[model samples]
Every structure is written in structure tokens, then in C-alpha cells.
Target chain A: NAGVTQTPKFRVLKTGQSMTLLCAQDMNHEYMYWYRQDPGMGLRLIHYSVGEGTTAKGEVPDGYNVSRLKKQNFLLGLESAAPSQTSVYFCASRRWREDTDTQYFGPGTRLTVL
Target chain B: LAKTTQPISMDSYEGQEVNITCSHNNIATNDYITWYQQFPSQGPRFIIQGYKTKVTNEVASLFIPADRKSSTLSLPRVSLSDTAVYYCLVGDPRITGGGNKLTFGTGTQLKVEL
Candidate 1:
């Protein structure tokens, strides 16, 4: 099974341009998260969803938005891309079982905002 | 939300055992400690996790002290492939709210050389 897969492994964007990152998980996980990893910094959560049709703000949700219309898909959208948004984006998913808390991450999408 | 602190970097030789410790002074009562490994240009991968005492898996072992203030990730017989940034995360997964959203800090970069 493709645990988690992200679309557009790499992309280049200009200021004010908008784009949406697609994240799909085949593991039927109940929780999905979107994060950005900057150099010399840890991965910071931008947004997350506990289940389908539910989304919430994360630690760094100022410049990002997310939607989880389907159980297997979570999308992160940038309304107005800025240079500060240039970083690697990761999508992770995990089951809702209380016994396990392991999250499976996708390869990551490298975004360059010029 | 609990914050984690770990070494910025560590160096070890191949075939040697490596232990990376993380301190979460304000960890909550129901918080769990988890570790993730990340290679260059890739997403972070779950390694091990535990609440208290010890937990072992195929890849590594997680040791949480009785006080629950700190935890250690032990890697046995490290190899070149083991060179990556290791992250420590603390969160409670049972809460359907924001409790499960993991907050990552600057991880420990482990360099395994021959």
C-alpha cells in the first residue's frame, strides 16, 4: 500500500501566486496533518484534520489553509504565496487507535517561492 | 503543549551504539514520547515511541524515565545509513482536539561515519 503520497514533488512559485498541495493516504487513517520543514528548523504543523470534513489550525497556520473533504485526501492551499513559504512540505497520517501513535509521512514536496 | 529539547548535533562511528536524549520538562500527564528519523530531502519516519519506562522496536528503543521529564532514543550498531536528523515529539493521542497535533523542535543531527 502507498501509505501516503504527495503530488508535485517539487514546484517553483512567484509572489502572490496561489497553489494547492494534494496529499493522499491509502491506509485509511483518521488523522492527517500538513507541516513545513525549514532548514535548521524542526517540522512545524500548518494545519490538521481529525477526520473527513473536519479541519483545524495548527501551530503555524497563518499563511496556509487546509481541507479534508475525503477520508483519504487532505489538501493544503496557499492563497498568496510569499518567499517565506519556501520550504519542504510534508503530509503525515495516522490511525485513531489509542494504543498506537505512529504517524506515516509522505516523501515531501519541495516548494520554492520566488 | 509540551516542548522538547535535544542536542543540535552528534557524531558517532559506524558499528557503535548511539543514544540521543530529549528533554520535555513540561510534558503533561498523558503525553507520550515519540521519535522520528529524517534523511536529506525526505520526510520524517517514525522510529519508536513510549509513555514510561522502555519500549523497543525493530529499528530502535525508546527509554522514558520514571519522572517522565526526559526520554532517550537508542540506536544499536549504527551504520552510514543511520545518519539523519532525529526528532523527539511529545503529545497525547487520545484527545480528539488539538492534543494529538505534534509540535517539533530543532532535532538532533546524527552523523554516523566509517
Candidate 2:
């Protein structure tokens, strides 16, 4: 399995510009999450989905939106990119099993907003 | 969600054992401790996890004290390849019911020298 894959490994955007990052997982996980990592800081969750068509806000959900239209895909959209949004975005997913909480992460997409 | 505290950085020589500790003094009863390793320009990968006592995996070991307030991640026989940022996270295992989401704090950066 390819596990988790992210599209557009690198991106650059000007202020107010919008873009979407796509994440796909082959593991058929029931939970998917979007997180952003800033320099010298650990990752903060932006949004997450417990299953297809269900989404919820996380610790740092402002300025970002997410959709889980399909069971295997999660999308993160930046409505108006800001300089503060320049960071590495990671996508992760895991199974719904009660015994395990292990999440598999994608390689990450580096975004630079000017 | 419980907040975690860990060292900002650590240095060790190859072939030596490395231990990174994380403190989560406000951890809840159902919270579990997990560790992840991230290399430069890549997404974080799972290392080990435990609710109490100890858990050993091929990559590392996780030890949770009796009080579950702090946990340690132990890496055996480190090499240059083992140099990376290590993250300790504490959260509830049930994502579908979601009370406390998984959170990552500024991880411990380990630099291994030859």
C-alpha cells in the first residue's frame, strides 16, 4: 500500500490567494487529520474527519477548511492565504480500532505564503 | 487535552543509548502516551506507545510511570540515522467519540554524532 500520499509537495502563494491540498490514503482508515507545523514548533491540528462527510474543528482551525467527500480522501483548503499560514502541512490517518491509536502520516507539503 | 513538556534538544554519540523524556503533569486517566520521530523535510513516523508500565517495539521503547504523569522514549544503539526530532503526545484513544484530541508539542531534537 502507498499508505498516505499528498499532492503538490511544495507550493507558494501570495496573500489572499487560495489553494487546496489533497490527501489520499490507501489504508481505508476511518479517521483523517490535517495539521500544520511551523518553524521551531510542533504540529497543530487544523481539522479532522471521523469518517466520510464528517468534519470537526481542531486546536488551530482558523483560516482553514476541510472536506472528506470520499472515504479515502481528505482535502484542506486555504480560503485566503496569509503569511502566518506559511508552514509544512501534514496529513495523517488511522484505523477505527479501539486497541490502536497509531496514525500514519504523509510526507508533508511545504507551503510558503508571501 | 494534556500539554506535554520535553527538552528542546539533545546530543549523543553513535552507538550510545538515547533517552528522551516528556512530562505531562495534567494527563487524564484514559490518556495514552505515544512517540513519533521525524527526519528533516519529512512527516513524523510512529515510534512507540504505552498507557502504563512499558511497551517495546523494534524502533524504540516507551515507558510510562505509575502516575502516568511522565513518559520516556528510549532508543537503543543510536546512529546518525537516528538523529531527528522526537515528539511525545498524550491523548484519548477514541477518536470517534473525541473528548481529547491528540496534540503535539515542540519535540526534542536529537543530534547524533559519529
Candidate 3:
């Protein structure tokens, strides 16, 4: 059972280019998130969705956009990729529970901008 | 949104019980402590989370003091496979507007030896 999967495990883009990172889950979770991890800076949230057809900004949503068109899929699109936007991107989902919940993450997509 | 601080790295032997501490000096009353494990070139995976006192699951345990100034992640009988970077996240308890779009700290790298 692929819990969470991200497409294009690795990608390279030029400055000002545009691309989309795809995340899909089979566990029927309602929460999905996108994040980027840089050296020494940990992971910063880019965007998230509580359910299908809804999305919101996270801690570092400046250069990213997200869309949740379906329940099982969350897409992260970079309108204009910059060198600062180059980082390892992760997609995660959460199972609802009271007081506490756990997040499951995908293998991640490494994007390098030149 | 609370800020968290963890060690830069730790060294432990196989089968040893390792405790990684996280400091959240400014933790609000509506904050929850969560931990995730990440290997090289992969997304961070959930380990444990707690609001107060102690909480345990099959993988690890989480301990939070009454003041909520700090939290500890305890890994019992760790193995070499457990050699990875451990991230401490402080998420809002009122995880509203969306699913918990967690914020990850710089994290602590735990190296398990033979």
C-alpha cells in the first residue's frame, strides 16, 4: 500500500521556469500538506488543504501554490521557479483523531534550480 | 506558532535508549509537541507527539513537562536503522484552517553505532 507518493523523484529547472509536483495518497486522509527542506533550516510548510477543493498558505508559501482537486491528490505548482525555491519538496497527509494526529509523508521530490 | 530548538547531533550505541530533548521556551498553551524522523534524501516520518505529561506508541515515547517549556523524545533499544535526523515540531493545538501544517525545527541528527 503506497501510503503517500510523489511524482518525479528528482527534477532540475532553470530560473523562472514553471513546474508542478504531484502528491497522491491511498489512505483516504482529509489533510494534505506541501513543504520544502533546506540545509540547516529544517522543513517549512508551503501550502496545505483540509479537504478536497480547498487550500491555504503555510509558513513559507511565498513562491508556491497548491491545489486539491481530488480527495486523494494534492498538487504543488511553482509559477516562477527561483534559485531560492530550489529545495527538497515533501508531501504529507494526516489521519484525524482527537487531541492528537500523526502525519505520513512521501519520499519527497528534489528540485535543483540553476 | 511556537518555536523549537533541538541539538545539532547525537551519538549513541546500538541497543541504547536515546533521549533527544527539545526546548520551546515560548510555547503557548495551545501548542503540541511532535517529532519526526528523516533519513538522507527522504521526507520526515512521524515518530511521536504529545500535549503534556507522557505519551507512548509502538515506536517511541514523548514527554512534556507541566510548564511546556520543553519536551523529550525517547527511543528505546535503538538500532542502526534508527540512525537518522530527528525533527521536533511545535504545532498549534487548535490546528484550524486546515490539517496540522506542522512546523519543523532544525532537528537533531542521531547516529547509531555498532
Candidate 4:
């Protein structure tokens, strides 16, 4: 099973351009998350959804928006990309189980905003 | 939120055992410790997780002390492929009911050389 897959492995955008990064998981997970990783840093959550139609802000939610219209899909949108948004974005999903909190991540999408 | 602190970098030789420690001073009662590994240009992957005592998996082992203030990730017989950034995260196990946001700090970069 393709645990998690992201669209557009790499992209470049000028400041103020907008784009959406698509994340899809086939594992039927109940929780999905969007995170960004800067150079030499760990991943920080931007937004997350506990289930379909439910989204919440995360540690670094500013300048980013997310939608989880379907259980298997989560999309992260940059309304007005800026140079500070240049980082590698990753999507993750995990099952809602009391015994496990393991999150599976996508390959990641590299974005560069000039 | 429980903040984690780990070494910025570590170096080890192939076939040697490597241990990376992370400290979370303000961990909550319901928090669980988890470790993730990331290679260059790839997404982070779950390595091991535990609440107390020791938990062993095929890839690594997680050791959480009785106090749960710190945890250690042990890698046995490391190889060049084991070279990656290791992240320590603390969070609640339940995701559907809320209050399960993971905060990641700068991870420990493990460099395994031959």
C-alpha cells in the first residue's frame, strides 16, 4: 500500500504566488498532518485534522491553510508564498488507536519561494 | 507542549553501537516518547516509541526512564545507511479526541562512517 504520497516532488515559486500541496494516504488513517522542515531543522507541524472535515492549527500555522475534505486526502495551501516559506513540506497520517501513535510520512515536497 | 533537546550531531564508526539521548524536562503525564529518522531529501520515518522502560524493534530500541524526563534511542551495529537525523517527539497518544500535537526540535544528526 502506498502509505502516503505527495504531489509535485519539487517546485519553485516567486513571492506572492499561491499553490497547494496535495497529500493522499491509502492507509485509512483517522489523523492527518502537514509539516514543514527547514534546513538543518526538524519537522514542525503547520496544520492537522483529526478526521474528515475537521482541521486545526499547529505550531507553525501562519501563512498556511489546510483542508481535509476526505479521509484519505489532506491539502496544504500557501495563499501568498514568501521567501520564508521556502522549505520542504511533508504530510503524515496515523491511525486513531490508543495503543499506537506511529505516524507515517510522505516523501515530502521541496518548495522554493524567491 | 513538551519541548525536547538532543545533541546537534554525533559521529560513530560502522559496526559500533550508537546511542542518542533526548531530554524533555516538562513532559506531561499523558505524553509518550517517539523517535523518527530522516535521510537526505526524504521524509521522516518512525523508528521506535515507548512510555516507560525499554521497547525494542527491528530497527532500534527506545528506553524511557522511570521519571520519563529523558529517553534514549539505541542503534545496534550501525552502518553507513544508519546515518541520518534522529528526532525525539513527545505527545499524547489519542488523536481523535484532541490534545495530541507533536513538537519537534532540532534532531540529532548521526554520521556513521566506515
Between candidates 2 and 4, the one scoring higher on DockQ is: 2
Candidate 4 or 1, higher TM-score: 1
TM-scores for every candidate against the unseen true structure: 0.97, 0.96, 0.92, 0.95
User: What is the TM-score of model 4 when looking only at chain B?
Assistant: 0.95
Q: List the residue pairs that clash in candidate 3.
A: none
Judged by DockQ cut-offs, the docking class of candidate 2 is medium
The Cα local distance difference test for each model comes to 0.92, 0.91, 0.89, 0.91
- The true-versus-predicted C-alpha distance at residue B97 of model 2, in Å, is 3.2
Off by over 4 Å in 4: B95-99
- Candidate 1 lDDT over B64-97, as tens digits, reads 8899999999999999999999999999888788
The runs of at least 3 residues in candidate 3 whose Cα sits more than 4 Å from the true structure, single-residue gaps closed, are none
lDDT computed for candidate 1: 0.92
lDDT of 1 by residue, A1-114 (tens): 989999989999999999999999999888999999998999999999989999999889998989999999999999999999999999999875656788899999999999
The weakest ten consecutive residues by lDDT in model 2 chain B span: B92-101
Docking class of 3: medium
Model 2: per-residue Cα lDDT over B45-70, one tens digit each:
98887889989988888888899999
lDDT of 2: 0.91
Best by lDDT: 1
Docking class of predicted structure 4: medium
Candidate 4: deviation at residue A51, Å? Answer: 0.7
**Which runs of model 1 end up more than 4 angstroms from their true locations?**
none
